[model samples]
Target: MEEERLVTQVTPKSEDFSRWYLDLIRRTELADYAPMKGMMVIRPYGYAIWENIQRLLDERIKASGHVNAYFPLFIPEGFLRKEMEHLQGFAPEVAWVTQGGADELEERLAVRPTSEAIIGFMYSKWVKSWRDLPVLINQWANVVRWEKVTRPFLRTTEFLWQEGHTVHETYDEAQAETLRILDMYRQFVETELAIPVLYGRKTEQEKFAGALATYAIEALMSDGKALQMGTSHNLGQHFARVFNIRFEDHNQSLQYAWQTSWGVSTRLIGALVMAHGDDSGLVFPPAVAPFQVVIIPISIGNWKENTLPRAVELRSRLERVGIRVFLDDRSEYTPGWKFSEWEMRGVPLRLEIGPRDVKNNQAVAVRRDNKEKLIVSLDGVEAKIKGILDGIQASLFDKALAFQKENTCQVSSYQEFKSVIENKRGFVQAFWCGSEECEARIKEETMATIRVIPLEEEKNQKGKCIFCQKEAGTLAVFARSY
Candidate 1:
C-alpha cells in the first residue's frame, strides 16, 4: 500500500482549467498518457467509475428493449465508400491498415472511425421480413481515429464506447426510437451523473453526417463551456438505400428500412470531472463514485486493537447492505493523511472511527461536497449512511443546476451574443435564421456554434434572427464547446 503514496497537489481549477484538469487526472490516478501519442491508459480507479456507469446505463438500455452484440473492428475500404456521406465525414480522422505481415494488402482496410457502414451492411443480411423490422442491437467496443488534437478521455486516438444501431420498418419508428434514447440519456446523465443538461435537436451544420436529423444532450461544465454529452441520430433510409437493407412487408411490398445510431463514450468520465469538480479535487456524485463511503480509523495509543476492529466491522455492515465502502486500516498513513488522500479521490462520505468513537459507539461522518461533519450512532449506521449519500447526490445536482442557470443567458442581438460568449462564456440563447451561412459566420467570428435548438413547441415560436435580423422563428443556444 506504500505505493499508494501521499496524494500530490493539483493546480487550482480557477487559475488554469487545462492544467488543473490534467494535473487532477494524474494526481487522482484516474488516467495517464500512454507511450503512444494521443492515447491514454485508464487506471483501475477510473475504470471502476466507467464500470459503474456501464452497469447502470446498460440496465436502462436493456429495459428499453435493446440487446448487446459485437462488431468487427476493421471495415473494408469499399464498405466505407458504400455511404459516401458518413465516410467523408470521418475521412480526415480515419486510420488505415495497408499491410499484412511482410506483404502489402491488395486493398487498404479502415480501422473503423465509426460502425455505421459495417453495421448497415450487416443489417441488410439480417433483415429479410417486416418481423425483423426493428433490429435493436448495441456493441461496447474500442474505436480508432487518428486524432491530431487529443486529451485524456475527452478526445483520443482510441477510446471505449457503446454504439447502438437499430432498424425500423417506418420513418416514424426510427424517429421515435431516436428521441426516446435522447430522453433516456437526459435522465441518466442528470440523475446518475448529477450533471444537468439541455436536450434538443441540432442545426443542419451540426447534425451527424448521413442523418436526417440529430438530437443531443448538452451539458454546461463548471468552466462555462458546453459539452455534448450524448447524441442520437435519425439516420432515415440513407444507409438502408446504400446497403440494400430491404424487407418484405406483410402486404408483400419490398421497402428500404429506416435506421438510427446513438452513442456515448468514455469522454463522460471527463464530463464528471469538469461538471462537478472543485479546486480541492474531484467531487463525484454518489451514484457513480467508485467508493461511496470510505471509513478511516483514527489512530491513537493502542488504537489498532481498539478502533481497527470496529472500523472493519462497520465496513462489513455497510457492505452487507450493498454500499461501496473502503476501510483505510493501513498503518503507514496517519489518519489525517488518509483523509486528504480519500478526499482527493472524491469519496462521497468519510467516517472517522477512533478509540473515543469506539467507546462512545459513534463515528464522525464528513461529506466531501460541503465538508460538513456529523456524529452518528453505530446502532443504525448503515441506514444513516444511505440517507446521507442520497442527500449528497441530490445536493450536488442542485448546486450544478444552479450554476448552469446562473450562467445561461438569453440575448436578442448579435452584439449581446458576442459579448456573452467572450465575457461570461456560457450558453447564450438567440434566434437563428436556420441557415448554415449564419451558423458558419457565428462560429467563425465568435468561436461559438449553436449548441442546441429547442425540441418542444418553443422551436416553432417566431423571433428575429440574431445575426441576419431576418424573419426567423427558431431559437438556438450558442456556446464555445469542447
Candidate 2:
C-alpha cells in the first residue's frame, strides 16, 4: 500500500482548487469513472453518504404531510408538449426513446428529465372537487438527461433524486408551499449537512420550466462558486390549465387548481464534498457521516494482544449509545495507515486506544474536521462523543459560513462585476433591471448568470440595472455555477 500513502500529490487549494477537488473526490473512494463517457459509478462509500442524506430528507418530507409514491420513468411524446414553455426549457437536453423490443415505435418517449407532465395527467383525473385539492406526493427515483458535459454528482447524464408534486386550491397556498419546501431544504442543508445556504427566488429567466416563480437555496463552494442545492417552484395554474385539472368549488363553479413542484438531487452530495472537503480528503459533518466514530487500536510490542480487548469494549459502549462506530482491528495495516484511511473517509471521531491509555483509564479521541486530539475518560465516553459530535457540526457550519461571507462581494459597475467574477470566482451581489435581455447579455459576455433574486429583497435598494444601468428593478445574485 505504498502507492496509497502518496496522497499528497496535488497542488493545494491556493494553487489550483479545481484540480484539488477532482483529486479529493477520486482519492477518497467516493466515486469512479465508468465505461460511459459522461456517467460515473458512485462507489459504496459515496452511496452510503447519500443514503444518510436521503433518509434524513425523506423523514422531513413525510413529516410535512407528503406521501411517498412512484411515477413512471418514461413519458409519452405528446405529454411533454402539453406545456409549451416546459418543452422549450427541457427539449435541448432530453433523451428520447423511439424503439421497443427490436421494433420501431411510432411515437417517441422521453426518459423523464423531470416528471411534471406525467404527474399533471394524473392530477387531472384524481382531482374532481376542491376536497381533492392539495395532492402531495413525492417520489424517490432516478432521472436521465443527455448532458454535453458532466461532473460526478454535480452534473451527470444520469442522477438520483426525489421529485415532489403537489396541488393546491388557491394561488396563495401554492406559493406558501413553494417557500415552505425551500425553507425545509435550507434547514436540512444547514443543520444536518452543516453547509450554510442563501435562500432566494430565481429571476423569471432563471425560474424552472412552467413555474410562475422558483425558490432556491444556494450554497457557496470552497472554490468561490455558487451551487444551487435545491429548489421549489410555484407552478401556479399553468400546469393545471394545460392538463385541464378543474376542481368543482363549493359555489358550484369549476376552477383551475394551483400547483407546486420541488426537488433536491444527489448533486447536493457534490456540494457537501466541495464546500467542506479539505486537503486530507472529505470532512463530513457528524449528523450525516455514515460512521461517526471509528476505533483504531494502537498496538506496540506485547500491547498488541492486550490492547485488542479494550478497543472492543469501547466499541461496544459507543454502539450501545447508538453511535455508528466501527472497529479497525485489521492486523495487516498499521495504526497510522488506518488513521489516514478513516480520515480520508471523513469519519467524524476516531478513538485510539493503547495499553498505556487503557491503563490510564482513558482513550485518545481525534476529530476529523480539525484533527484535534484529546484524552477522554472512559467513564462517560458516550456522553463525551455526543458533545463532540455536536461541536463538530457547529464548527463545520461556522467555518463554511465564514468562507461564504469572505467570498461574497457587492459589485456596482459592469467592469467591477467582470473583474470580480474572473478573479475572485464567488457570489456577486448586484442590482439588476430584471430584464431577460440583460441577463442573456451578461451571460454571453462574462459567462455568469443571475443565480437567484434574494427572497428578502433589500428595502430601498431598488433603484439601474447592474450591467446596463437602465432602472434598477431588484437585487439579484450573479455567479458562475456548476
Candidate 3:
C-alpha cells in the first residue's frame, strides 16, 4: 500500500505543465516517440480514444449527406502545380517521394499534404453537367508534412484526419456549404468533445490557399494559447478554373463550378488533453470516453474471496445496460493502483466495490473531472452511472466555457491589446481597419495574428483600428495560435 501510494504522488500540478503532459502521456501508455524526429507512435490506449472520435464524427458526416471515398495518397508534381497558390502555400512542408525501390522516379511524387488538387482533377473528369453538381465526398487518410518541431498529437510529420470535398454549381450554394460545414465542426467539438469554440471567418491573408474565403473554429487552451480546432474553406472558382471543372448551364452556356473543402485532424485530441487534463492526468468527457466506467474490486486479506463475485456481477449488470465498462480483475495490482491508472487514462467514472460496500449493497462512484465520490446503491447502479456520465459531460463543457469567458478581453487601444495578450493570453476582441498592412504590422510586433472576423458585423461602435487608428471595418478576434 505504501509503494502504491508513492506512484500516485510522482508528479504534482505546481510543476511544469509541459513536463506534466509528457509524464502523463508516458505513464499512461498513451503514446511514444518514434524513431524519426517530429513523429510519434500512438499506443493502443491513445488509439482507442482516437477510434471513439472517428466513430462519432464519421457518423455525423455521413448523416449530413457526405459519402465516403478514397483518392491516391501520392500526387504527381504537375497535379499540385496546376493550382499555383495551393502549391506555394503547401510547398514549404511537402515531403517528396523520389525513389521507387532502386530507381529514381522520373517526376517526383509529393506525398499529399492535402488532396485538394487530386480530388479537383477527378471532379473535372467526372462532372460535365449540372446534374453532377454537389459531389459531396469525404476521405479518411494519413498525410505527411515535414515539420521543424512537433508535439505528440498536436503537430507531427504524419497525422490522421478526415477531409471533406464538395462541389456546387452556384457561388451562393458553395458559400452556404462552407458555413454549414463550419457549423457542423463547431457542433461536434462542443457537443461531442465537450469543448467550447469561437466560430468566424479568417482574414484574406490567413485564408487557405486557392480559397476565396475560409472559416474556422478556435478553442482556448488551459495554457492561455489558442488552437485552430478545424477549418472550412470556400474555394470559389479557383480550383474549378484551374482543373477545367465547368458545367453547361440551363441556357446552354458553360460556367465554372464552385468548390469547398474542410477538415479536422487528430490535433483535436491534443486540444482535449491541453484543455481538460490536469496533473492527475487526462479527464475525458463521457461522450468520447472509450470506457465510461472502470470497476475495481478492493480486497485485503480474506476479503478477496468474497469481493470478487460482487465485482463480477456488477460488471455484468453494467454491460447489460449498454455501458462500456471494464473490470480490473488483476490480482497483481492493488485497488489503489487501479484507481490512479484509470484516472490517468481519463475514464469518466470509476466504481469501487469492496467487501464492506458489497455488504451494504452500494459502491463508491468517483468522477474523473472533479474527483468527487458518492455512494450509489447497487439496486439501480446502471441508471445512476448513466446520470453521472451525462453530468460529467455537461460539467466539463461548462468549465471550459467559463475559462474562455475569463480569458477573453475587449480592448479599445493598442497598449491595452498588447497588455491583454501578454498577461491574460486569449482572444482580444477589438476593432480592425480591414487593411492587410495593419494586420502585418500587428503580427510583426506581437507575434499574434487575426484569428477570426465574426460573421455578424457590429454596428455604430466601430471607430478606428486598435493599432493603426484608421477607420475600422469590423470586429476581429486576434490571438497567438498553436
Q: Choose 1 or 3, whichever is better by TM-score.
A: 1
Q: Per-model C-alpha lDDT, please?
A: 0.92, 0.89, 0.89
lDDT (Cα, tens digit) per residue for candidate 3, span 367-456? 999989999999988888899999999999999999999988889999999988888788889899989999999989888898888777
Least accurate 10 contiguous residues by lDDT in model 2:
1-10
After superposition, the stretches of candidate 1 with alpha carbons farther than 4 Å from their true spots are 1-8
lDDT digits (tens) for residues 380-416 of candidate 1: 9999999999999999999999999999988998889
Task: Score every model by TM-score.
Answer: 0.98, 0.96, 0.96
C-alpha RMSD by candidate, in order: 2.7, 2.2, 2.1
lDDT of 2 by residue, 1-482 (tens): 35344457544555688887777778777888889877888988889889999999999999999999999999998999999999999999899999999998899999999999999999999999999978999999999988998888899999999999999999999999999999999999999999999989888878898999898999999888889999999999999999998999889799999999999998988988888987677789998887999999987877556898888999999899988889998888999889988887789899999987989989999999998999999999899999999999999999999998998888889899999999998899888887888899999998898888888884566657887898886888899988
Which 10 consecutive residues of model 3 have the lowest summed lDDT?
1-10
Clashing pairs in 3: none
Task: Say which candidate scores most in lDDT.
Answer: 1
- Candidate 1 vs candidate 2, lDDT winner: 1
Clashes of each: 0, 1, 0
